[model samples]
Target chain A: MTVIDVRNLRKEYGPHVAVDDVSFSVEHGEIFGILGPNGAGKTTTVECVEGLRRADAGTLEVLGLDPHADGKRLRRRIGIQLQESQIPERLKVWEALDLHSSFYDTPTDWGRLLDDWGLAAKRDTPFAKLSGGQKQRLFIMLALVGSPELVVLDELTTGLDPQARRDTWELIERVRAGGVTVLLVTHFMEEAERLCDRVMVIDAGRVVAVDSPSGLISRAVPEQRVRFRPSAPLDERLLTGLPEVTRVSMTGTRVEVSGNGDLLHAVTSVLARHRIVAADLRVDQPSLDDAFVALTASRPHGSGGSPGASEGASDHRRG
Target chain B: MTALTKYELKLFLRDPAATLIVLVLPVGIVALFGVVMSPGGGDAIETFFPSAAIALGLGQLGMNLLPSTMAGYREKGILRRMAGTPVHPAALLGAQLVVGALFALVSMALVVAVGVVAFGFGPPGSIPAFLLTFVLGVMSLFAVGLLVASIAPSGRVATGIGVAVFFVSIVFGGVFMPVESLPAFIADVGDFTPLGAFMRALRASWAGAWPEPLHLGVMAVVALGFSLLSAKMFRWE
Candidate 1:
């Protein structure tokens, strides 16, 4: 079931178009990602769908109601964690949570949620006093307090260490398991790749590509790269005739075998067959980040060119 | 509307400056100012008591109360945050007015209490006249406070403007100085200003029936216009 659907949405701020003819639908209990660079209108599009902004042109329905026309009802059902979660600087974390909960007809208890978000000890701390991670956690906890049917998280993890990022990812998975539909707007490709069941790559307020991470990568470029550092300089001829090898390139002792799948085994086996020892072997797979870079790089300056323009823009080689 | 009003009243009271100016400060100022104006005699205490009460109400409201409300809210971004909510932004303008009125009412009661307790200050014979004057004085000063907040860019500026306005008005408004001793223009200007009218209305009420309904009526128009203008000009993020 489609929980939310946005079709040909357009919003302009005077002469500048913030969200241009964008369209996508979120399914029941699915994690949907909208990936784009900063100022790419991902947040604007999401805000429009959330009924925070009035669309200049488009049709948007969340939970079977128009986002703008039925905004009051839609707001009650959808929980939004905006790009900037602003709370009063003087307000304590617990106080803010309680105040936000007051707006909803039925809200989750702050006591349990405080512990869940690892903010029990910081209950009395003012909002400005919390660390960045702690603030983000509190912001998310406030968004979830209403037990909303649809959750929208914008740039959920922009600044966090690796471990914190992973923990947030696990929390998101838990949210998904609770049968809540999530629509995420983010600039982090790795986050999109790891979490999104399906993602829409937006550039300058338009959907350039939409598919699973692997699906989009494969669609853009169907090549695998195998890389290895041989004990000494490797001759190009030894790897030139392998069945799986389409292109063999060697930069000093770092040999990169560009071909389809199983090229790594083929290259290693052939090297061994010839008594050529290899070390520090690394396999480079075409990633969502690479595909995104390729698609966005080719797009017209701020106008946001076609999808797949950013492909090959990064140094992506498998070893 | 009433629910929002109640909520605004609660929030406004939470401010330290607001609590001081409205709830506690007015009561204190009235008693303290009453001492300065008190002349010890049979009729001296009664005559001076009403004047001092009116003076305290006017001084605190114009000088220390409403300006702080405007500046504090601007600093906290309270107005901007409220603007985005389902509540009508105009309600906030109304909320500020209600808070001022609350303070005004509290000030009136404190002065009346202190007037009777320390210095026998109540109407000679006419009850209605004295009460009418007290109410009008509050309305006039509250109007002036609103105008100052609307014009001041920040709380500090408002505070400066408020103090200046209060001192000028109290000195010339005939609280301590008689109208006959002042320059004709200064006396005339004081008569026309809300503070002047407030003092006249309160003094007349003590004498008998309110001396001038027109003065009170004009203040109503000014207060209405000032509040409406505040709604139009208030800035929010």
Candidate 2:
């Protein structure tokens, strides 16, 4: 079942069109990702879908309910944790959990959440006293407190240390294992590449590309890179002459051979005959960030719609 | 609804800044007035006590009460946090108003008890008129307080604005001065403001002094209007 369906959604904040004619769908229980650069309309699009922002024009259905007309009801069925919303500075860790848990009708066990989020030790500490990783864990625990079928997480791991980031990733996998659909709004290419089943790269408020991570990388920049440290010297003429070699360009010890079919064997045959034995060889594949840069480089800058004004804007009351 | 009310009360009571602004400051304002002026104008304790209570209530409800309550909630993001909850935002407003009323009543009692015991203050000719003043005073001040909170972007801003308004209303509204003692223009302005009418009606009812009903009615109307507007314009985030 498609839990969320957004068709030709457009959200304009004055001059800049934040989300421009964007369309996408999220299947039930799928870990879908909306990926883009800093100013991409990924957050805006998700906010519109979550019923936080009313699109200038669009039709949105979340969990088979209209986001705008039935916003309150839909919100009750889902869990949302905003990017910058840390619990109040004075609120104790357990107090924060208890307060948030009270907002839902059938809440997850408070004690269970404490243990699950690894916040049991810090239960008595106030929010201001918490470390960055501790605070992030508390937020994640709060987000899952209601046990909703669909969870909307906006930039879940923006500023965590490496170890904390990995722990968060594991927690996300755990949440997915429980059968909850996740709508992740993020700019981290590694996160999208690692966790997202299928990715949507939005640029200038429009869908530029959508597919699995490997699929996107391959589709955008196909072929493996041939790199090797020359044991002696390489004969460029014979290597370039191979039928599978589409392009060959090199400087110093590094050499890039791009082409199709049996290139390893074909290049090896040429090197062996020429008495060039290459050491320290590596076959490189493009990462999600590389594909991300390739995809959004063409988009206009500041497409996220007033990144500066967004901080002070009072319009956050809706979405 | 209960959760919102409880949360508001918890936050209102827990916030160190709000605790001082709403609970301590108003009581301090009242204590200052009691120390500065001698109670009773020779008629009886009834004559002077009610007027003192009115002055103290205004200090509690109007000047100190409204601004800090609203501003504090806005500043703490308590209002914003409550907005997203299953609890209705209306209940949150109601909770603040109730809390203001709660603290105002306690302050009024404390001020009155201290006045009667220390300054030989007494009640008014009619117990009913005095009770009316208390009821009207609480409502009027709560409305004005809501208005202040509605307008302020943060608690600190609200506190600054609230304190300024409180002193102005107290000095010009005749809470500290007799109407005849004020310049005519100042007295006229006082009649229109809720604080002015509250003090006038309260003094008159207590000292066997009587002012036009129009003053009381006008303040009541302003309070009602402000209460509605505050609830309407309030923002959570």
Candidate 3:
């Protein structure tokens, strides 16, 4: 079932456009991500879906109900953790959980939730007293207390240490494993690559691409690389002559090859045939981080309306 | 709603400013005046000091404490966070009102107790009328506070406006001088203000008479008008 369907979504802040004709649909049980840079309107788009902001144009439906028109009904079934929302500083962790529980009709047992989120011992600690990671863990617990079918988490791992971020990623996976569809809005490429089933890359209020992590990487930067130091001096034409190799360069007795489709197999076979054994060979495929940079940075700034302009430019470059 | 109210009450009690304003200040005001100002204490000290204490407490809670709490919640995004839930954002305001009114009543009771124990002041002659007047008085002042909360953009601004209103309300309520001592025209205008109307009704009940209809009507109208306007003005963000 499509839990959320947003078509031609448009929102603007006065003269400046925030979300421009954005559209996407999320199926049940998929950890969908809206990956974008700062001021990319990722938050605005989700706020419209959460019914926190009214969309200026377009059709949005969540759980088969209009978000703005049926906000009360939608709020009951969906949980939202806003980007920078906060509870009272003096409010204790347990009290915050208990108070949020009162807002839902059938809240999960808060005691168990505390233990699961590693916040049981800190339950009596005030919000001001908790560390940043502990506070984020509590926020997640509050988001899940109602056992919502769909949970929207925005920038949940923004300011955490490496280990803490990894732990939060695991927790998010656990949330998805519990049969809940997750909508995550984040700028972290590695986080999206690890958690998202598919991602919609939004840049400057426009959809750049929508695909799985690997799909986006392949679509953006298809050239895979192979680098090695030659055991003996070899001719560069040996690599450049191959059909799979698009570009080859050499420096200081080391050679590098970049091409599309099975470049590793092609280069290794050629090296084997030429009796030039390669040492310290390394293969590199573009990461989502690389793809994200290419996807967003490739656009000529402020040219969103004419979609084919950038596409044509890239085509010219490829040709 | 009960759970929210309980938590809000806990927060109120735990706050040092709320404790000082709602619990300690009123009692201190009554004691200060009863001992120092009314050395040759008589019916006037017994009646006027306790009434003034109630007015002072209401002014502090309604204009200062209530608005500050509401604006603080909004400033810190507490209301916005709660807006995502099935619970209405107004629930926080409602809980705040409940807790503030509760503390006002407690403060009034303590002032009355101090008046009796410390200065041999007499109790209100009409119990039922006193209770009615107290509830009405609380409603009127809290409504004004809610209006301030709804309009102030931040906690600091709210506190500033609240204090400004507090001084203005108390001056007209005859905390500095008896209403009888004020010029007739000023007293007439004072009857329409929350603290002024409250004082008139409280005095009447203390003197063993039902409050004048005009004073009661002023409270009703101000309470209704301010509450409706503030409710409309309040923004979750």
Q: Give the top-scoring candidate (lDDT).
A: 3
The sequence of per-residue lDDT tens digits that candidate 3 reaches over residues A1-319 is: 9999999898888778888768999999999999977877899899999998999999999999999999988898888898778898889999999989888888899999999888899989999999988988998999998879999999999989989999999999999999999999998999999999999988767778888998888888888999999988888898889999999989887898999888999999988998878899999978998888878775545433332212322211110
* Residue-by-residue lDDT tens digits, candidate 1, A213-253: 88888766567898878885667888888888899887766
Q: Give me the displacement of residue A194 in model 3, in angstroms.
A: 0.9
Q: Which ten residues in a row have the lowest lDDT in candidate 3 chain A?
A: A310-319
iRMSD, all candidates: 4.4, 3.0, 0.9
Q: Least accurate stretch of 10 residues (summed lDDT) in model 1 chain B?
A: B80-89
Over the true interface, candidate 1 deviates by an RMSD, in Å, of 4.4
List model 3 lDDT by residue over B70-150, tens digit each. Answer: 998888888888888888889888999888878888998898888777866777889998999999899999999999999
How much is the TM-score of the A chain of model 2?
0.87
* Residue pair clashes in candidate 3: none
Each candidate: what lDDT? 0.71, 0.71, 0.86
The DockQ figures for the candidates are 0.20, 0.27, 0.71
TM-score of chain A of each: 0.87, 0.87, 0.93
Q: Would you estimate the TM-scores of all the predictions?
A: 0.77, 0.85, 0.90
Proportion of true inter-chain contacts also present in candidate 1:
0.00
